[model samples]
Structure formats: structure tokens, C-alpha cells
Target: MENMRSENHRGAAMEGVKLASEAAANTNRRALRDIKNILGAPHQPQAVSKRGLQEKPAAAGAKSQPSAVGHRPVTRKFAAILQQTQPANAPLAPIGSERQKRNADTAFNAPSDMECSKASDDDLDEMMTNELKEIDMEDTEEEEEEMPDIDSCDVGNSLAVVEYVDEIYSFYRRTEELSCVSPTYMAHQSDINEKMRGILIDWLIEVHYKLELLGETLFLTVNIIDRYLARENVARKKLQLVGVTAMLLACKYEEVSVPVVEDLILICDRAYSREDILDMERTIVDRLEFNMSVPTPYCFMRRFLKAAGSDKKLELLSFFLIELSLVDYKMLKFQPSMLAAAAIYTAQCTLNGCVSWSKCCELHTKYSEEQLMDCSRMMVELHRGAARGKLTGVHRKYSTFKYGCAAKSEPAAFLLDARRA
Candidate 1:
């Protein structure tokens, strides 16, 4: 009886151990299944259709069919499942079933808020690009307007006129101080000076008659000749050569139709051969160094007339002064301003036929004529003492000019006759 009781107890104990092992295994399997479900299905996957995300069923079974006609729920659910399986950072796939799958994946996995933020950045970039394009267009237009055309060369030519005016003014100022000085101070021997001057005057007159150039140009050439001679103690024999050379230089500088070297030689009555004149021309050009810039009485006359504010009177004064300049080679040594003023004074006297001291004073003040009297007096004496034969050509030219004037006006004829007497 005791043995049978002990066997029963052993069997019961083994049975209890087997039941405990089975129960532990079942508990482990259930815990593992719960963990997998939580991690794999944390959120419901979004449905995708060919068009876009399919609308969710309003209530369970409210849309047993898809919201869109002919749209299948299984297709949308498969797309959503595929999208959910894809990695978040994967690049978009090419267009086709693969691209559709990728698009579905992007839509399902990507947050709505994140896509909205990226859209704002793309809009900002586009706006910036448009603004930069507008700025570039504006810059192009401004560049086109600012660029100058090649046809505007006339504007450059006009600007060059101011340079000429400045050059004339500078020449006037340089000779202003020498206007008052006497010719005796300028010469060592009076008798020889007189004879040489006469020869120079005669040669000048001949050239003037042949050229028929304006009086303004001739006066300028003569002034240059006298001024150069006064400054340099050149020999009396070289005086004619110097005069011709000076005239050539002046003509080249001032005249539009300049005479050639051959023409100048011929005009000098073959006194200078072509070779001789050419040699002299080279020497003068070298000495002057092409600096033939000098003011003429004509230039000063314009300035004085502008200051005086009388165009008609200025015209009359210019005619007489230019004519007188031809007769008196001494005037060449005077400053252009002094000669211009004196000529104007002389004309005024001739016109009114009276001596007005007050008017003379006003004129002197206006042109500094009183200051220039010494130079004017010296110039007058040089011409008065000049030999008569030297001025043969000059006389002929002046006679013709005077005759033309006489034909035009009684006042001019009377003035010419009075001047001869």
C-alpha cells in the first residue's frame, strides 16, 4: 500500500512540470507578437490613386466603393502600402509605375507641413530670379543710352574753337608791355634803319597786291616780321629774306589758301631762288619752332568792339585801322590792342571832324590807348621816315582798295584823300 501511494505522487509532480513549461512558451510568443504589431503598424498608411491620394472612407463601410468613379480601393491601398515601406530620404523615381509608387511613398511618408514649407522656399527663389532679371534689363537700357555715336565729331570741332580764342588772348597779353616803347630805343643807327624799313615796306606792298589777301592777315604777317627784327640784331641784307619768310609763316598759320614756296619766290621778283627760299624757310621754322601763334589787330578790334558795344562804329573803325596798318610798317611793332585802339580813335576823329578830349580819355580807358601811345608814336615815326620807293607795291594795292571804297561811300573817299594829303 505504501509503495503504490509513492508512485502516484511522482506521476502527479511530472505532469505539473510539463503544464508549467507549455504555459511559459505560450506567454513569450504572445508578448513578441504584441511588440511587432506596435512597431510595424504605429500609424495607418495613406491610400494613393493614379490621380492622387484617395479620400478616406467617411465611416467604416461608407465607401465600400472608391470615392472616384472606376477608382479601385485595392489599387490605392497597395500603393499606400508600397509608399509606407520606402525610406523617407529616397530620390523620386522616373515616371511610370515605379514613379507612381515613389510619388505615393513621398506623399504618405512626408509630413504635410514639411511639403508646405518647401513650396514657400521655391516661390521665394523664383521671385528673386525675376527681380534679378529686371535689374539686368534696366542696366542694358542705360548702357545703350550712354554710349556716344561716331557722328558727333562736330561737337568736338566746336569745342576746338575755344582753344583758338585762348591762343589769341595769350598772344595779345604778351606784346602789351612793348606798345609804349619808342623805335629809337629799338635801333642802333637811325639812317640805315629808315632805308632798310623802306625796302621792306615796298616788298610787302608788292606781295600784298599780288596775293589780294585780307588786310587782317597781312597786318599780322608784318607785325611778326617787325617784332622778330626788333628782338634780333639781324643784318640789313637779310631783312628782306626775314620778311618774306615771316610772311610765309604767317600765311601758313592764318590763311586758308596759303601760297607755295615757289609762288613766294616768284612774288619776290626772283630776288630769292627756290633753293634759297627753301633754306630760309627751314631756318625760320627751326627758329620759330612752329610757334607762329600771335594776336592780330583784327582780334583786338573784335574784343574792343564787344567792350564798346557798337557794331556799326566798330565796322567803320576796323576798315580804317586795317587800311592804316598797310601804310605804317611801324604799327607792326606795337601790341595788337594798342594798334586797334589807336585806329579806332583815328576813325572817330575822322568821322566827327573834331577833337573830343573827353571822348579820347574814355577810349583810352576802354583800350589802354594812353599806355600804348609810346609804341604807337614809335610805329608812326618808322612809317613816316620809310623810303617812298620801298612802298611801290603797297601803294598800288592800297590805291585799288581805296578806289573800291571810294565807289562805295563818300566818307570813305574823303578819308582816303585826307590820308594822302
Candidate 2:
């Protein structure tokens, strides 16, 4: 078709013969393309009727129908039909730049009844398919224009893909349950208690901040720790080894530059050597079967914050609370989604001094104010204790100017009032 280019648009040429030749040339090009396409395909049957074959058996004095059709194959029948049609029109003439003798440029006689009856059903099928494709494309374009796009100002960033974001989060919501460990899994541990686990996390929080890692890397680190501990029993001495090894694995998974074994060992004041760390890494990988991609509160935190149409302060405070919950073992009772939703709810109550769980938040988070009350109350308590608690690593980290002093914000005491009543 591209090779059939000709100057035949309106006012492109004044000669009537040139226009007629151009039209005939385009039609011939289209027909040849269709014929070549059909011939290239496999296992196609001819569209001929059985009427001609039946007459042969009748005239030969055979009383029964033959089990087979006539001897015309698909390619032979198509070639014969096209050849007959070409001679019926006129002698071919060159019309376009690259004319290869396929130009039907002369005037044609009207088709006979037999000629029109010979039209194959393939032409009708092609026309219907083209029309349906056009209609479907138009409908999809309209639907895209009508649907609302929800994302941060970073939609311009190619990494923040708008398409499939909702589906991704919806899948996160459904499978979040599998990511959670038993709330009371600490009871079966022989060496580490919840308090010791909290201390390990507090130290890790400090290490994470000092390393200047991404927020997601921090969350993934904690998830790796909890999941490893849930499946295996570590000795009291090896517990810190687990924390360091988990953080190392998480950095490999989430960061471009990970801390080396020497840096981690130095942080622990050379308590463990390189071989111990390497051995611990191997043990953790084997115990957990290398399943590290799990959703955490940070995943839901970003999403619920977006749904709330939150300002910078609300975002910080929400993150501050969720990080605090990360240090406390009691928060394990709630799924990552619930913990995230409650953090936002508690943050909203603290900042606005009233219930501000909007319909959009509820719809996206799949939780209402009432349903989040228990978790919200727990988060509020963690907030109250953050400034003065032994696990004040999260508080001191958030209180810095970089975090906008999110830790200094007053706790949502109003949520605790309902619990007391």
C-alpha cells in the first residue's frame, strides 16, 4: 500500500484519467494484499459450493451422493477466480511510482450475476472485523477519559505508574493476611522476649537513620526480622546477629548501596565477626525460604495518606506513629493495613481535634472509624509513650527537623477517652 502512493487527492491533479487510474491502482493493491494474506495462512478450506460436484454423480447413473467434494483446492480455486476477474476488466497499465504490472487502470464492464454470486464470505468477515475493532477502540478511549486518575503530584514521574496502581494495592489488601505472623508467636520463643525484640528494633531504627537509607528499606528490614524470628528460635546471643543480617538482606533487596559486614559489625562494637554474620545470613535465608517480598505498614501508609488528601504535617505524623508501632510487639495483632489505617486515623484526630475519617479514606482503606478504634487507641498510647520510652529511638529520629518534628505533636488523647469509658 505504501508503494502504491500517488498524487490523487482532491486538487492534487487536474487530469481525469490520472485520478481514475489512481483509484483503480489502489483497489488492485488492496485486493492483491488480501489474496497474499489468505494464501500464506494454513489449513483453510475453499468457499465453493457442492452443487457442481453433485451433478457429476447424478449424470453418471449413481443413485447415492459421493462421500467427497470436487477436486478444487483453496489456492487453485482462488487463483482461477482472480485470473478470470482480471481478464474481464481490461489490460493492466502502470499507475504508481513502483508499478509491478498489478495496475487495473482501464474502465470495467459491470459484473454479471454469476460474477457477483462468486464473492467469498471472507470479504464480509474482514469488513465486520474492521468495524468491530474501530468501535471497541472508540469505547476504550472514552472510558479512559471518563475515569478519574488518583495519584500524587508525581504522576509526571514515570516510576509512579498510574495504570494498575489500584489493582496493585487491591492485591496488597487481599494478600496482606499471608504476610502477617501469629500475634502471639513470641510465646513460643525460647531466647528472645518481646522486650528484647523491641530493643533490637530500636537499635536498628538508629542504624537505619544513620545509614541514610530509604523509608521503604527500613520497613522491609523490620518485616524480614519478624518473619525470621517467627519461624526459627534464635539464641539470646544470636538475636542481634539476626537483626543485623536481616537489615543487610533488606538493603540488598531495596537499596542501591548496602552497608558491608564490617560496618554492621563495627556498629555492634565487634561483637560478631564476618564469618558469624555470613553464617547468620545463610541461616536466615534457609529458615525463611528466601520469601522476602511482603507488604508492610509503609505500603498502606502512603496509600491512606493519599486517600486523605493530607498535608505535609499529617503525612509526617502518620509515618511517625506507624514507625512507633513497628517497635512495639503488641501492634502485631493488627495486619499491616489495619496498623496503617489506624495511624492515619489517630494522626487526623490529633491534628484536627475531631474525627476526620472521610468516606474516601474508608473506601480505600477498607476500614471505618469504629472498626479502627481498637488499633487507633493502641497507636495513641504508643504515641504518648514515645517521647519518654526506652524505645525512644523512633521518637528522637522523628523529632529531628528533617521529619518536621512529627514526634513533638501532641498524642491523640481523645481516642483513649473512649477506651476508658
Candidate 3:
């Protein structure tokens, strides 16, 4: 009986052990089921519709969109699940469908109090793009209005000018500073006299005419000579060499085909050897600091003539006056623009017998009658001197009808008196 009871006890113990093992297995299976529920069904699953891709529904009253520019934060476990679910070689989801799914996910996962419903990121992006386009269009319109329309203007006038307007204006705006030559610069000179300077200028004009060089070449030659004199002391004998060398430098800077050094030597009757000319050229250029950008009265004369409506008579008279200014040392005190304006003013009054500055003159030249009086008086004196044949080169050049002979034409005595007044 004792043996049978021991056997029953052992059998009952074995049965209890089996029941505990089963219970443990059941608990493990229940936990696995809860995990599966949390993560959604794991299987050889079909591709999900974009609308139903999320593992779980978001909490109620959550925002419906994500931030526009930045991305949402994702946890590592979620990324791992994504990596495991999608095969490495599988075709990607269509971009539109993927974006829609991401939008829905972002909206569902967003904080409830946030304003996700205001606009989707894509919608906001499109709206911002349109706003930026409108702003750019407005700016373009304003710019078009502010800047002159080069296309509509005359081709001859506008093409080159409009293309390089900014560069040209920047260059010419420094004219006063670049062209300033001290009136007293010649006071210390020993060998060079004002009469000799005038003669040199007259000869240069003749050479300019003979060579058929551009007006710019003549203007630049004169500029170089005056600037060199301002800085250097050339002996009386080397003066012609200086003039010829200055012309050569000017030709090189302004001409398409520069005059030959041999030709320049011949022009001066071989008074200067090629070596002497070249040596002086370097010396003059060095002393002037290679600042050959002096603005001449001729540059301003052209603008002033155009401002005065390009009157044939007035243009000739103004040209004659400006050229006369070039030969006179006394006229060096005035700026190039001032000389041009004064020339124009004197010419206009001589032609029209007007005492006051014309509106066109004031509008274009930006000078008042009072400001121009002194220079005008000086110009009137030069014109009279030319008329009397004292200033012969300019007088002879304008004596022809081609130049309207305005140099020979005299302003009334009252106009001369007004210049003095």
C-alpha cells in the first residue's frame, strides 16, 4: 500500500509540471499576439493602399499636416520595421502616392493643438512660389520703367550708348578730377612761352588736318602736351619733340593704326631722332603718371552742341571758341566743361542777341547765366581776337562756309557789354 501511494504522488507531480509548462507557453503566445497587434499583421503581405499604410490610427483631434520645410522625427524601431517589411530590390512607391501617405501620417501623428489643417506643406510651397513670382514680376516692371528702353530708341543713337551707358558715365564722371591742370603750372617754366605754346597748338591743328586723324587724336594730343608741361620742364629746343611725341602717344591710344615713329620724326623735320622721341615719350608719360585720361573742352563741346539742338551755326561758333580756348594760357583756369558751356553761351547770344541763358541751355548744360558770365566774357574776347585775325588757325579753319563762318561773324557790342556785366 505504501508503494502504490508513492507512485500516485509522483504521477500527480508530473501532471502539475506539464500543466505549468502549458500555461507558460500560452502566456508567451498571448504576448506575441499583443505584439503582432501593436505592430500590425506580419506576413507575406500585399502592398498597402496609401490611405491605410499606418500601423495604428492617430489620437483624436490631432493636426492634419506636417511642417512645410523640415522633416518629422522618426524613431529607430520604426525605421527597422520599415527596412524589414520592404525587400531591398522591391520597386519604390510612386512619388505622388508616397507623398500622400507621408502627408496623412504627418497629419495623424501631429500634436492635436497644432494648426496642421491650415495648409499642407505642398500647398504652402506652391503658394509661396506663386507669391515670389509675382514679386519678381513687379520688380522687373519697376526696373523696366526706371531704365530707358534701349530697343525703342533710334538704333544709331542707342545701340552702343545703351549697351555701355553705365561704364561710359562712370568714366566721364571723373573728368573734372582727371582733367584738372593748375593754371600756375606754367609760372615756373623758363624756355616755353605762351606765344610758343599757341604756335605749337596751331601747327598741331594743321598736322591733324593733314593726317586726317580722328578728332579724338587731336584732342588727346593736346591733353597729353598740356599735362606733360604741367609736370615737366622741357627746353625750348625739345618743345617740338615733346609735341610730336605727345601726338604719337595720343595716336597709339586713340587710333586703329598708329602713326609710324619714322613718320613722326619726318614731321618734325628730323629735329628729333627716334631715340630722343622715344626717350622723351617715356619721360613725359612717366612724369604725368601715365594718367592720359584728361578730358578736353571738345568732349564737352559735342555734348553742349547736341544740347543746343545741334544748330549748324551755333555748333561752328562753339567749336571755334573752344579751339581758341585751347591756344590761350589764360583760359586754363576754367574747367573743360565750363569752357564748353561758356563757348556755347557766347555763341547762342551772338546768334540770337539774347542777354539771358536760354531754357534749353540751362536744362542741358546745367549752368546759369551768372555762372557763365566770366567765361563767356573771355570767350567773346577770343572770338573778337579771331575775327581780327590775331587767332589765325581757328579763324582760318572757320572762315569757310562749311563751318558756317561763325568765327568771322561778330556779336553785337551790347552782347559784349553783357558778358562784362
Candidate 4:
């Protein structure tokens, strides 16, 4: 009896374990259904019926006796319930056999995790290449959009762009006269002529500052002085004489009103007599052949700036070029036209902050930026050499004139006299 009771207790424990397992499986099925509903998957009653059918064989096989023998009616009732609940699309397959076949197929065909990772890497490489190709296409489209249409009306006068080349060439030819009055010519002169030249330049610069005529008048006066020197071989003693006369001529030609002979002499610190100035003036008028039609640096500067499409950049360049003129008498020998153009080009390059050769060429299509660079270098070198020791001369003369002669006069009187002078 004890052994039989022990065996019954064991059977009861196994039955309870089986019931618990079935209950857990049912809960897992319900959770899966809820997840499918949340994901918006269509209701798959046929799949559910198939899953139920798969679980049944294990339950039936656990029983040792054939259920058809002892529970025929119960078995029939179970079959009727199954038929009623089963979905129409459920496959007619023996549960254990079909599941085993499916497992075998999955083991043969499915990729391992390592294989999947390599496929992902290949997919990423392909995606990156395609993305790069799209970016290139976008860049091409943007370039096409930014390009100006040749047919547009606003592009006006294609020839204007090319015309500057000829203009630069023509200006170069016009200023060829400068090459004749080289620095060597000035260097070879006697001490007296050199001293007179120095004195003359000093007076010219003084007149320029006093008159407040700015660099334009100063440039014109210097050109007149150089041209006169080019034509006549005046002595050094007469250098002041030539300078005053040339300034008088420039004042009349370039300024609003010409300074009187008395004013010119006074500005000279009484170094020049009225009679001496008058005589020198006559000589200059005759030597120049009374043809005072001299070209100025400003004229060329304007033209070149226009050609380079940089009229807006003129003020700074003009100031620098004018200051540079003060440093070099050799610059006077350069046709006002060439120096002006060259100065403008150099100033533009400096201001725009372009360092490379190609960038400057791109900015101004007319003379190669290389040619402009060479021209600027030559001008600066010539200026530095000629300008040596000249600033002191300029300062001494201006200081004497400004303090000694003009100090007693009214500010307005001084300004007027300076202007006329």
C-alpha cells in the first residue's frame, strides 16, 4: 500500500507539472498576439491554428494508452471542437513531420551572424558611393546655375574687356619719351646742376603743399619740369629759376588761379628775384614751344582703373602713387600715363590681397599681371634709388617757407597765396 501510494503521488506531481507548462505556453501565445496587434499586422487565424496543431502531438504522445480506446466519445468531442475553431487556410500537415522538415530547411539556408555582418559592410560601402555621386551631381548643377548666360543683355560690350590691352599698349608708346631722360642722365650732371635740380624739386614740393593742390598738380608740375629739362640743357644756378617758372606755368595751366610773380619770389624765401623769374619764364615758354599740352598721371590712372573695373579703388592708390612720386625723380621721367597705370595696378593687387600670379591675371585681363608686377618693381626700385637723401631737402625748404615767410600772414591770406602760388 505504501509503494502504491508513493507511485500515485508521483503521477499527480507529473500531471501538475504538465498543466503548468501548458498554462505558460498559452500565456506566451497571448503575448505574441498582443504584440502583433500593436504592430498592425493583419489577423492570422490560420497561423494561430497551425501553431495550436503543432503543440497537440506532444500532449497526445505523453499518454501511454491510445485515447481512441478508452475515451472515444471524448476524443470525438475534441475533434469537433478543433474543426469548429480551425481557420480555413490552415495547412493539412502532420504536426511533428512538417515541423522537423521546416527546421532542417532553416538550418541549411539561413545566414550566420558573421555572414550578415559582412553583407552589411558591403551594403554600407555601396550606399556611401551612391551618396558621393549625388553630391557631385549637386555641385555640377550649382555651377551651371551660377554661370552667366552669354545671351544676357547686361553683359554689354565684350570688346570693352579686350580694348584695355590696346589702351595699355598705346599708353606705353606715348610714355616712351621717358626712357630718354633716364636716371643716368640726371646722375651725370655737374654738381651745380644737381644742386639746382634738388632745390627746384624742393620748391615744387613746397608749392604743392602750400597750395594744397594735392598730388595731381604736383605731378603735372613735375612733368613740366622734366619735359623742359629733356628739351633744354639749363645750368644748375638757374635750377631754382626753372622750378619757379615751371610752377608758375603749372599754376596757370592746372590750378584755379596763377600765383603772382611777387608771391612766387616770396615763396622762394627771396632766393628768386622777380626779374630773374620773369626772364626764366620767357625762356621756358620759348623752349616748350608754348605747347603746354602735357599728359598727367591722373589721366592714365583713371583710364586704367576703368579698364580694370576698379574705379572705386582709386583714392588709396592715387595717394600712394602720389607719395611715391615724391620719392623718385626717375618716376617723373616715366610718362605720367605708364606710372599712373602701373601704380593703379600695384595698389589694386595690394589692396585686394592677392599673392599669386594667376589671381592678379584673373583680376585684370589686359596686360598680364606679370607685366604689371614687373613694371611696378622697376618703378619702385627706381624711386628708392632716386629718392635717397631727398626727404631732408624737401623738409628744409618747406619748413623755411612755412615758418619764415608765411607765418605772419592770415590763415586765409596764406591759403589764398599758397593756392595762387
For 286-387, candidate 2 gives per-residue lDDT tens digits of: 888888888888888888888888899999999998998989999998999999999999999999997779777887898988999999988888988898
N/CA/C clash count, model 3:
1
TM-score of candidate 2 on Cα atoms, chains taken together: 0.64
How would you encode candidate 1's per-residue C-alpha lDDT over 273-374 as one tens digit per residue? 878767777776665555566556676675554444444643554444445464554554555666676555444444455422233234323455355445
Each model's backbone clash number: 5, 0, 1, 1
Which regions of candidate 1 fall more than 4 Å away from where they truly are?
1-171, 174-192, 231-233, 306-333, 355-365, 368-398, 401-421
Using lDDT as the measure, which candidate wins? 2
lDDT of 2: 0.81
Model 2 per-residue lDDT at 272: 97
Q: What local distance difference test score does each model get?
A: 0.56, 0.81, 0.73, 0.56
Worst 10 residues of 4 by lDDT: 406-415
| Candidate 3: residue pairs that collide | 64-107
Ten contiguous residues with the weakest lDDT in model 1: 405-414
Best by TM-score: 2
How many clashes (backbone atoms < 3 Å, residues ≥3 apart in a chain or on different chains) does model 1 have? Answer: 5
RMSD of each: 21.7, 20.2, 15.9, 21.3
Could you tell me how far off, in angstroms, the CA of residue 231 lies in candidate 1 after the best superposition? 4.4
lDDT of 4: 0.56
